[model samples]
Target: MPFISQIERQSDYSRFSSSTPIVIDNGGSYFRIGWAGEDDPRVVFRNIVQRPRHKTTGETVTVVGDHNPALLRYFDCTRSGPRSAFDGNVVYQFEIMEYILDFGFDRLGADQSQIDHPVLINECPCNPNQSRCRMAELLFESYGVSSIAYGVDAAFSYKYNQKKGICASNGLAICSGFMSSHAIPFVNGEPVFEACCRTNVGGYHVTDYLKQLLSLKYPHHSTKLTWEKVEDLKMENCYIAPDYASEVKIFQKGDKEAEEKTRCWQLPWTPAPVEEQPSEEEIARKAERKERQGQRLREMAEAKRTSRINELENEIRGLDFLVKQLEHVPENDVPAFLRDTGYASKQEIESNLAKATQSLRKAKGEQVENEEKGDTSNAEKYNLLHVPDEMLTSEQLRDKKRQLFLKSTAEARQRAKQRKLEQELEREKQMKLEEAKRLENPELYLDLLRAKYQELSEKVEQRKRQKTNGNNTNGKQNGSGGVGRGERLNAAQRERMRLLASAAFDRGKGEDTFGRDDEDWQLYKLMSRDNNDDEDDNEADLARVSARLREIDPTFVPKSETGSPAEPPGFRPLTKEDFQILMGVERFRCPEVLFHPNLIGIEQAGLGEMAGISLRRLPSNDEALEERITKSIFLTGGSCQYPGMIERLETEIRMLRPCGSAINIVRAYDPILDAWRGASQYASDMQLFQQQTFSRDDYFEKGEDWLRGYKFRYTLT
Candidate 1:
């Protein structure tokens, strides 16, 4: 069963007499306090505190114990996390411990200037003298207590169990607390401190381990794995696998059992709203708007074109009139007539007229028909080509050479057009052949298409790799790009880097003969950055293949858009099972560590081994005493609540004892609170008022060390 804290303030503090002793069970995980003789503690709370700043007021406020989380909405707790007083079962930080003590006493209704009653507080086994003294001093000075008694919490539990006739007077008390585990053997109703064993592993370590593993497994939901929530998860679901490796193997194989074992906790999630497709009216509205915008743009463009055409037409008319006016003049007077205009000569005026007509046709969106125009003026364009060398002067020969160059250029343009027409015919023929093959067998056609696609993709990929390497080399040699210090470069890049470095330092060693030969100029070409742009067509081919595959194969997945080697992992929707941290392996694993500390990270011996160690420490190894202790093996502490704890301990202890030796173990009725109940009952006995319980004078004169040797007589009480 999951443990719940009871920390309600008690109103009957005045009902108890001033001489009544107060019982306090100061455990690492919890604190319980009550008036002497009470069956249960009047006040109990988690042994933790938080100092949070109020959000609205901006003032730091001290909040002790667990409070309503809703009330904490007004506070900003980011700066300070909930802190515990105990460190590995030892109260080290007195400042935090003081706050806890104050909260405990205040809730117990300590209204007087000081507490008038004596106090009985629980402590750990082999309680350090330094820690003991601090506790005594705090109670005496702060609470004004008459006297203080310190006893191991486990021993009190064992004694309480013994009173209920659960076990013999002599037995082992395996007490597992929050941060540590301990095993104490009770001999003749008294605990033997020398025989006690301690292991630095308990409920806290198990919860922390579960928390870390889960956070690593589901990094996206790490914030959900709070310490308190993980603690609850550990208690509710975690369990110890009898055989760890085999149990994990079951999960690894993903059997039905493993499927059943997996639990999920659903986090809050909301479905995204669905987008509705546009209605017919909406589509029509958008189309109308687009058409209107296009009409406006078209009109503006037409106005611009008309303005340009008009300007060109006016300029052509003026040129035509000037040429006509020049034609009216006599041939001998034409040069003088052209001089009146801007023209240098008759030929210059005719050339200006031709240029204006060509520009006007172009502005009007009419094809210039260059080939037709060229053919019509061929005789004039190459007039000197037909003239023989003997029929022309040296100046005429120069003009013939210019005509030959123009004729060759026109032939080259004609040849290029013929090649383009032939390519179009070849593509059409190939399409007909493919259609005939597809008609024979559709499956075979698809297979052939896929094969061709694969071949093209591989060719494109290889070309891309080669181009990338080439670009890296060019970049390295040009000193424009370098790999980061921690990054790795391609092989070509590394080689180019080496060559450039060697060339830089090779300068002063010999005479300058770098570009003496044609081969030497090739080095400049290799190092040039212009070579990197050559792969653009190859990348386009790869994109074509990828698009084709996507159209054909519905299941085909392209490489990641991130360009990384692998895709970044994303979080799947959390189910109820994901949030649940199953305790199958952890249940017994945590409690078992109390028996065998090596299971956890601790190197100390377990409870059973420690019992043997404790027995060996005794001055006299008496068989009867060992037998007595084995008969009354009382289990205690908050952590002794696992289902199979009694059976597991009994079996382990039996293995340690001699073959025929008797062994017995029993659990307390209420391991968590029985210590406080036992203390309260003991303090309430009237005969407990001995002279040793003492006057105030005895405490002052004897000093603190005198209080260290103080022992309680439980049998008398």
Candidate 2:
């Protein structure tokens, strides 16, 4: 069953007699307090305290234990986390502890000038005397309690259970509490403190260990692994495996039974909506719209061209009329006629007619056929190209030179076309041969393809290395030595370092002849940035292989742009699985420390050893006493609730006992609340009034030393 706090403030505090003592089980995990002789605690809460400044008021408020997380938004809690009074299961910080006690007592209906009733508080075993003294002083000075009694919570629990008839008067009490676990022998209904053992491990360590392992395994989900949530998970799913090695083997081999044992948590995820393909009718409409747009553009261009051609033709006719008029009026009148027609002379008018004719031809979309014309008019345009220079005029000589230039350009174009055609045929033949080989044995062909891809990939990788190496060298050549201070390079970058060092040292040695020749300049060019393309061919080959593999293997994926093989560093997204913290070994591992205190880095005897230690501490070493103690080994405390805890303790204690000694280990009826209940019942006794010694004089005479050594007789009340 999951444990929960009972925090409703008691209303009948004033009704209880003034002599009735208040009992508190102040543990590291929880704080429980109630009137003596009650069957249950009146108030219980987490032992933690928080001090947060109110968001609106900016005043620090003491919040004792866990509350609604949403309400915490009104306070700034980033500077400080929730604090506890305990330091390794012992109360070392009195300030925080005082605040908690104040809250506990206040909620218990303490409205008087001071707490006038007697108080009973639980403390850890072997608590430092300084801490105990401070606690006593605080109660005396501030709260003004009439009297105080200090007792161990585990021992109280053990005694409470013994009275309940759960165990004999003499037995072993293995109490695994919040921050620590202990085993004490109850000899004749009294605890043997000197022989008691403690192990500094409990539920806290178990929860922490599970949280760490889960967070490390699923970094993405770490945010959800809150301490509180992990605690819940630890209590819910965690259990002890009798044998860790054998249990792990079940999971390691992935047995069917292991699958049944394994649990999974599905995180909230919604797949992204996929895009739907456009409808046929929609696609047709789009195509039609595009075609209509193209038609309109074409029509607009044609109209513009027609208008230009008409303007050119009109200008040509006007120019022709002016030329005709000039021919009739003679050469002297030609300039006047040309000027009226926007032409300088007859030659100008002729040039205008020729330009208009060319415009008209282009507007009609007819090829100007300059290259074809050059071929057809070869003899007429460049007649002197075949003739000797001695028989030609200077004008003819220039024409022959122009023809020679045209002929060479046409020859170059023809050669390029032929080469391209031949290369295309060669590629087609190679592709057909590869296809035939694939048809022969598809599986083998795929294997070969994969092998080829791997080879090509390696080559490309090597080439990349070479390029990077070359860059490093060039950087060094530019006098930028050894990369950056903290920069690391792949294998190629390191090789470049070696090359650069060799090149640098090789210079100026037996060679004052460094730049004596032009070849030395070429050496610099070889080492230049542009010369880093040593693996271009290898890259091209890889590209081809990758393309071929993609064609054959449906599963083959080419990683180039976004799928580069580089892992990102740092936290990823958390899943529900991360929120699911499982504890298999942790359940026993935590409580196991009760039998082996060394597990939690604590060098102390465990619970089993503590029983023996307590017996050894006894003033009496009688065999009958030992047997009586072994007969009533009572288990108590919150931690004793584990399934096989009682049996394990019995087995361990029996081992330490004599060959035929009788041993019994029993669990308390209500280990968590029995101590407070028992104390409450004791306080209700009218005789308790006689034990109450109040006033400042009694405390003053008692002194701090006497308060430090104060012990309670639970059975007396």
Candidate 3:
């Protein structure tokens, strides 16, 4: 079950007597506080602290435990993550721990300046003297507690189950807490700390392992696998395997039982809307509208052409009349007649008449191939008679130079056209040869062309991928492009980043003198993310092969835009199964870390090995004592609640013990809360409480040396 906090304030704080002791289960995962002799704690919360800045005040405020997320939006908590008071199961940071206690006591309706009653808090087994002294100092000075008593939570759980007659007085307690696991042997109903075996694998490690595994498998959905969500998944599905190797073989072979055991957690997803094709009536109406628009454009073009033909005819008539009038005048009067017009001489008028005649013919939809076809036809077209400049006037020399430049330009255009026609002839000749070979052996021709087309297509595809991202050379590419860029970068991309950094820092030269040089602009082109200078020469060759294959092989399909194979249209609607995270072998594989700590890279005893290690470390090797301890193996704490934990622990312990050793493994009724209940029950007796507990003056008088040897008596509880 998921853990829920109870931080509501209680109303009856003054109802208890001054001598009444308070119990607090200072667990690594949570903090449970209440008055002694009660069945359950009055207030419980996550033992976490957050110091966030207020949005309006810009001052930091201490927030303990979980609060409404909407209310937290008013604070800027990005500067730090949630801080824990405990490192492993031992409290080291008392400054943060004081805030936790303040919240716990405040929530329990403590409005007074000081707590008049004594307090009982649980700590880790064999906790360091420095940590113990710090806890005592914090309680005595900060909270003003009358007295304090320390105990191990696992020991409390063991004695609580012992009081219920669930196990014998002589036994072993395997308590798996949040950050660590311990196997403590109980002799005469009291825990032997010297024989305890502790491993740094617990519920926290199992949940963390599961989170990492899921994140790596479905990396795109890693953001959804929050610690809280994965913890819930672990509680619901994780379990201990009877034999990890044998259980894994079932899943590896994909047996029917494995499929039955698998569970799935579906995530939230919404299907996108599908587009519908146009109806036949709509298509017909669109085509009709397009035809009417085309008709109007055709009428407008005809009217423009007719108007241009009329203007050209009128201009030609006017020029003809000028020529006739000039012919009637004398040669000397020609200069006088031409002065009225814009022409400099009679040859200039003839030049204008010839150009008008050519333009008029061209407007009548006639070709001008003969006009620009041959260079021999226009040898004298720029006729300055190849004259020397000394024999001509200054104006004549300028005209001759202009004519030479025009002649050269026109010849160059003619040469380019001739070359293009020659290439076209060569291509037609190749096509005829190919047709002959296809007719001779159609099947062979089809096979040869198909092979060539496939090879060229692969080459073109490879070149395209390399140009887009050189890192995609390996097989990390999915349809979603390639591997993400954060973890990796191609050589070109790295260079670009280096250039950008260099430009920003000015190479440590100081002063803002960028963009002064012309070459500096070229640096931006190299640094640009979209700039790809690589050429694709194979694309043209692939197009040629694809076109040839299409001519001979009717079944041939191309991947180009115009010849692409059609896929059935429309998207498949998303289903619940598409978003589900499947738990097959992972359901047991992750929890198997409890029995094999090496799975998570920790070289230590696992949960099952801890029991064997604890038994071996006993001072005496008495068979009867070992048998009694094995007979009443009590399993407690949150991690011990997995489904097959009892059976698996019994099997692992049996292998270490002699033949037919009595191994009774039983779980606590409520592993999480039983320790608190046990502490409360123990603190009820005033006589025993007064003997073990110490006041603030006693703590200061007797320092760390005395606190090191102080131990709680669990047998009396």
Report every candidate's CA lDDT: 0.72, 0.71, 0.83
**Best candidate, TM-score:** 3
1-717, model 1: which lDDT tens digit per residue? 111124566687888887888889998888888888779988888888888888887887777777767877888989988898787888888888888877787788886348878787888887777887777777777678887777778877777777888866777778877888887777678777777778787778777777777777778788888888888777766654544467678877878988787665566665546689999999999999999999999999999999988888888888888877876888888777766776766665666677778888888878896676675367656767877899998987987988899899988898989989997898689867866887788678768767766666665656554445544323353355543531334455556667765664465355655566777667766875434343554466557556756765687665534355766779765455555444344444444566656665778876667667766666578988887777767777666666666676666677788888877777789878888888777777745643326334565777678766776555552
Clashes of 3: 0
User: Which run of 10 residues does model 3 get worst, by summed lDDT?
Assistant: 529-538
Clashing pairs in 3: none
Order of all candidates by lDDT, from best down to worst? 3, 1, 2
Local lDDT at 264 for model 2 = 50
Q: lDDT, candidate 3, residue 329?
A: 90
lDDT string for model 2 (1-717, tens) is: 111123556688889877788888888898988887777787788999887777788887777866667777878988767899898789988999887887788678786349888887788876777887788788888888877777777677776676667877676677777788776766666666667777777778767776777778678778888899778766665555545457667777877877676645444565546689999999999999999999999999989988998898887787777767776886676667667667644554665676677777888877675565455355554555789999988987887888889877877898989989998899899999999999999999899988888787776665465446544423343256434422334454445555554654466564455566666665555555433354565677688888888778889877563468667888856444545544434444554555565665778776667677767766778889888878877777766676666676666677788899988767788878776766666556756534633334567786777655555555562
True-vs-predicted CA distance for residue 263, candidate 1, Å: 3.9
Residue by residue across 13-98, what tens digits does model 3's lDDT show? Answer: 98998899989999999899998888999988888988888799897777788766777788898995799988888888888888
Please provide TM-scores, in order, for all candidate models, with all chains considered together: 0.68, 0.68, 0.75
lDDT of 2 at 231: 80
**Top candidate (lDDT):** 3
Which of candidates 1 and 2 reaches a greater TM-score? 1
The lowest-lDDT stretch of 10 consecutive residues in candidate 1 is 1-10
User: What TM-score quantifies how close candidate 2 is to the native fold?
Assistant: 0.68
